[model samples]
Each structure stands twice: as structure tokens, then as C-alpha cells.
Target: MTGWTTANILSTLFGAALFPFMIAVAWGKMVEVFGAAGGWVAGFWIVGVSWLLNHGLGLHHQAGDVWIDMAMAAFVGLFVQSTLAGGKPGKAVPALISGVLGGLLGGLILSIMA
Candidate 1:
């Protein structure tokens, strides 16, 4: 097992930090058209499908820990956003923050135990 470290965790977190924002920007229209809940539904599906395409298909290795971290972040973010948004959800910003934080935490653990 590898050891977890603060540096690696930070690396992962920072690396993924801007990803959610980009995703939000690109998909913002779809989300707005669908409404918050609908946006989440579509967003989650997109995330899942994209993960499968990228990870399952081995399209890229640079995003190695993305799936797990994003999943964790998305779920947690969804909950937090829904709560904070007062029924309406803001997917991109929250998801990005959540995903980055979650990814960093996951990377820390993985690096430590890997």
C-alpha cells in the first residue's frame, strides 16, 4: 500500500478544481432549460456516461481518480446544493467544489494506501 500525503491530495484537488466550472459553463444551458432537479438528473447521467466512456474505455489515464472522487463529490454536492439553494440546485459550481475536495480527500487516502 502506498502512503497518503498532503501534497498529492492537494495536487488532485487543484487539478480537478477548474473542471466542474468548465463543465458547468458548457452544460449550463441544458441545466437551465431543464430546471434544477432536471438539470441534476441530466448532469448525473452525463457524468456516469462520461465516466464510463473515459474510464471504462480507458480513454485517458490522466483522470485516473476522477470517477470515484466525482461520484462522491456529486452526491454530496447535490445534497448540499439542494439544501442551500432552497429547493433549486446549482450543479456546476457546487459540484466542482465538492468534486475537487472529494477528489483530494480520495487521492490522499489512495496515495497513502496505494
Candidate 2:
């Protein structure tokens, strides 16, 4: 309310409307990259993990916080994709390791940003 302005309001409204479209595009791309189950898992996992990290770590929420969250998400997505791709038990270790690495990288980037 304090910073409300016509331009801000309009932009917010536009962004809200565009958000779903963006999600759909992302979803499609994920599905293409990872196939159906992996894609869905990655998409949902990103949201869940991001929420947990943001709140659990007590990280300050800011406009660019999503960049780090998304980076982690991509790491998770790739892990899921590779795991599902092989459909092998042994792949789990590699997937987890890569995901953890991705998460570490994302955190590092976030720290640098801060």
C-alpha cells in the first residue's frame, strides 16, 4: 500500500496473469527434457524444497531470492531426470550427489549475491 502506484498495480496484475503461462512453458520444457514423471517430480520438488529452504534457514526473502531457489530446482530436476532415465538403482547415488552439488552451488551464488 505504501508504495502502491498505478504502474505498479498494472505490472503486478500483468505479472500475475503471465505467471501461469510461464509455468506452463517451463512445465512443457521440463517434460521434454525429463519425460513426464521426472518432469512433474522436478517441478513440484523445486517448489517444496525452495519453500523449506527459505523458511527453515530463515533466509531473508527478497526479490532475487528465487534465482537461488530456481538454481537448486534445476539441479534437482536434472537428478530426477537422470535417475528416471536409467531406471537403475545404482543411479540414485549419482543423482543425489549431483543434486547436492547443484544445491551447494546455488547456495554459494546466493551468498555471493547477498
Candidate 3:
């Protein structure tokens, strides 16, 4: 058995498509649990959990590609939200963390839907 199976492929696509919402949902949970600091790593947490799920399910992703995409999702999701809210690129950890919280929230929502 391997991730190349059609089932795995479809599941991957499904997960990928709903990632935005997942971030949202996850972020809210993270904030509630870890407070503002949780945001710093919430995005990474989602990517880590999601990747683990994929691998556990036997999905095959090529060399770092999955990680790269996941990281991008985490950063971009948060970045956009923060930019809109503050109209600037935050340099401090709090700023980054807050942004990630937003992404986490999105991820959580996606997970619920899925």
C-alpha cells in the first residue's frame, strides 16, 4: 500500500483545497489554548499535524514539496490577514504570532468542514 493510490490523491486534494478554512479554525483554538503566544507556532502546528496525517494515511509527496507548500499556506494566510488589519509587515514575534493565529483559525474551520 502506498500514497499513490487514487484514494490518497483525492484525499490530498481535498485537504489542500480546504486548508484555508482549517487555518482559521485552528488559529482560534490555538489562541484559546495558548493565548497570543500560541499564534507564533499555530501555522507550523497545522502544517505538522496535516503532514503527519497525510503520511500516516500513506500519501506520497515528493521531497520537501509538501513542506514548502504547507509553510507557504501558513505564512501567506497569516500575512494577508495581518496586512489588512495593520497595513504593515510586523517585525516582532507578537506580530508574527498574531498573524499565525489567524491562519490557525482558518485551518481549524477547514478541518471542521472536512
Candidate 4:
């Protein structure tokens, strides 16, 4: 233990919580814009973003990391694809694509950070 302090623990908690918060915020916005279809699009966007954050942070093999990654991946792969395929292109499609791209970018960011 490297003398973990309150700041360190709180930082960790906040960092971890941010992922879900982002998903909720983005997803809700998407839903508002595109309804169920947008929700689907937002789902993928969340995954891509989450993946990037998780991998970028490169958190050690913690249970929380596992949960976040799994949740994000599932939404991106399943919901995003389905949503885009089901409906015409709305704002959601771009958002979803951006999310995945962002995740990739996040990987690069992590390389620099780590």
C-alpha cells in the first residue's frame, strides 16, 4: 500500500463513476433526439467511450474495470448496431461512430499517459 490517502481513494471512485455517468448522459440525450433509435446509437457510443477510458486508464484487473468494460462493450456492439440498422440516420449514428473512434483515440492517449 503506497499510503493511499483520501484524495487518492476519492479520485479513484470519481474516475470509476464517471464512466456510467457519461453513458447515462449521452444515452439520455440520444434518446431525446432520436427516441429508441437514438438510444441504440447512444449505446454503442457509450461502449466505445467506456472501452477507451478503461483501457486507457489501464486499471489493474479490478472487478470494477471488468464490469465497466463488459457493460460498455455489450451496449456498443448490440444496441448501437441494431439501432443504426433499424432506423434512418439521425444524430445517433454519428455519435455512435464518434464514440468508437474516441475509444481508439483514448488508447493512444493512454499510451502517452501510461
Q: Name the top lDDT candidate.
A: 3
Candidate 1 TM-score, true structure as reference: 0.36
Question: Which scores higher on TM-score, 2 or 4?
Answer: 4
Kindly provide the TM-score of model 3 when superposed on the true structure, using C-alpha atoms: 0.39
The C-alpha TM-scores of every prediction are 0.36, 0.29, 0.39, 0.41
Per-residue CA lDDT of model 4 for 1-114, tens digit only, reads 455666656554554565656765577788988999988887687766665655565431343423345355445444555465585447567877998899889878977996
Error of model 3, residue 102, in angstroms:
21
Off by over 4 Å in 1: 1-26, 62-114
Provide the global lDDT of candidate 4 against the true structure.
0.62
Residue 34, model 2, lDDT:
81
Cα lDDT tens digits, model 1, 61-103, are 3434534544444455445544665754554678668878986
Residue 3, candidate 3: how far off, in angstroms?
11
lDDT (C-alpha, whole model) for all candidates = 0.55, 0.54, 0.63, 0.62
Expressed as tens digits, the lDDT of each residue in 12-101 for candidate 3 is 556554455567678778988998878768867766676666554534343434343544544566666657667566465687687689
Regions of model 3 farther than 4 Å from truth: 1-5, 32-34, 40-44, 55-68, 72-114
Q: On residues 1-114, what C-alpha lDDT tens digit does candidate 2 reach at each position?
A: 554666655544443333343344466677788899867785686455444544444332334425433344344445455456675657477867886898799779978996
